[model samples]
Target: MDLDVFVAAHQAEWARLEQLLGRGRRLTGAEADELVALYQRTATHLSLVQSSTPDPMLTGRLTQLVARARATVTGTRRSGWRDAARFFTSGFPAAVYLTRRWWIPTALISTAVGVLVGWWIATHPEIQNAIGAPEDLKAMTKPGGGYETYYSSHPAASFAAQVWTNNAQAAAICLVLGGFLGLPVLYILWQNMLNLGVGIGLMSSADRLDVFLGLILPHGLLELTAVFVAAGTGLRLGWTVIDPGHRTRRVALAEQGRAALGMAIGLAAVLFLSGLIEGFVTPSGLPTWARITIGVAAEAAFLLYVYVLGGRAARAGDVGDVERADQTATLPTAA
Candidate 1:
């Protein structure tokens, strides 16, 4: 058949098939199968038309038709805030479970284990002498320095500034390192673990473990958890590119990016707040119980927001008929 005739015929059939498909709630299995068959027939006709034609206009028309079909099959509209809220909340429990079940425990255990091992190794008289321990370690059997000196030197303002800077740096690292194709992010996590371990070890060795915990535990829990969550987000992004499963890599990455970015934003907020607590509140001689209570409350609030409040907001948004109608209207239609 001539290319023009073939194109005109396929366009009519396509329109008819679309109308049939749109007539009811959804296409039944048999209807869906028939639709698939029609699509195959369309493809075959287009292939034959292209092979038979030398005219540029015919080729261009064929190209345009294929492009439209591809878009119809793959294109998705940008989800509005309501859709975003729903997705964010719906996934909250899973996020919390993942963090508490694995991320938090892993970071805590790893740091504790490293600290224990390091303290044991460092404090051994034989090793200490062999390594020619620093004079200060021998000179001060008691942990030196008071809260006044530490707070005065590092002040709340300075501390908050430092925390904010570090949190920003960590967030950037999570986004960049996690997007890589290899184990770069894992390596980054390992380095973080090592630093945490060493700090714990040093504090323990100085017999200032309680003091250190008082200062860190108040905010470290939130700040470090945020880091892990960010890393997890990155890992998901990398996984989409590396192991896209059934979907094309590009599609997988786009979908995962949307979900992961939401989590990352939440994590960044956590880090910022944690920094504030660490710099200002943690340094004050607040009662240990009060600090612990506040820390627990913060964590609880985070959990509730991510798991409960977030989900409720999303569901409400999803059920907004007016909003969905607006969205549908704005979406591009098949030509």
Candidate 2:
């Protein structure tokens, strides 16, 4: 790896590649072939210099030449509608489906927590008393009272938008902060389940648990699923920090982070649908059975989307990451 000797050998090829690149779209067939050949040789030369007896000045010059040649060899890539289509149908859903082992358990465990909290609050007069006076509880949980009326207090359209915004923010927080070893994500989940448990506990104490279910079931099914997905994904991100498996920590994080970001965008759309159900269907004049059915249908559709479409995409090697060409290049490290 004599640096001077190597530079002397390949300097002319590097210069020729640069001149061909400067010609832009005017390269003849023979010249284009020559350009491609020169580009390959220069790239190898750059790699050799970088890996052994590196010279900063020589490295910088060769790096620039290789990058220019690469761009000319492979035209620039731009994202278009096809990319968006692939994302929703393949990338986003596939990422979610792949994380099923993590999130499915998350959903089950969190649900149990909510139910246990509700049961504890319902049966314990001491806890209820600590929360508020009997009169206040009655005011809040009675039929057509605070719990039921809250959904309709605001106009339906505005309420839907507000719900969407809040849920999106919550999901985004889980995804972004999950990299903190998942502690913050866990606390956020606790707070959410606690709120739900209080509502259930108060309503059950008033002998209006059925009424509460009727109101919540119309949207809770899907809304909670999205939350669970975000939480699970965040936990996975944190776990990567602990055990990146075979990949380097930085590489694993980059891959997971990108997937989580795409998941956030996808979950926003899911939450938006649930928000619609909460704002309009939850408080509408429709029969309880009908509204709940609509909620169930929407939830079923989402599950199908994740399992069928996402499963297929994941099997085909889609990890919900941006296409390879879109990713930044990373040099290999010697162990």
The per-candidate count of clashes, in order, stands at 3, 0
The whole-model lDDT of each prediction reads 0.60, 0.91
lDDT at position 265, candidate 1: 58
Predicted structure with the largest TM-score when compared to the true one: 2
CA deviation > 4 Å runs, candidate 2: 1-25, 28-31, 34-69, 330-335
lDDT (Cα, tens digit) per residue for candidate 2, span 46-88: 7778778678998888888888888888988778999899999
- Global local distance difference test of model 2: 0.91
Candidate 2: residue 241 lDDT (0-100): 96
- Best candidate per lDDT, number? 2
lDDT of 1 by residue, 1-335 (tens): 56557666677776755554456566678876766666566556556654556467755654555444444444545667876664445554344344344356545665666566567644665644543355744343244454324533687887787877877677657656666852676666677776565445555666676766776677777777677766666665676678877765655565555555555555666777887887777766779778867777787777677556545644444321223322211212233
Give the CA lDDT, 0 to 100, for residue 162 in model 1. Answer: 84
List TM-scores for all candidates, in order: 0.60, 0.86
Q: Assess the local accuracy of residue 200 in candidate 2 as a C-alpha lDDT between 0 and 100.
A: 88
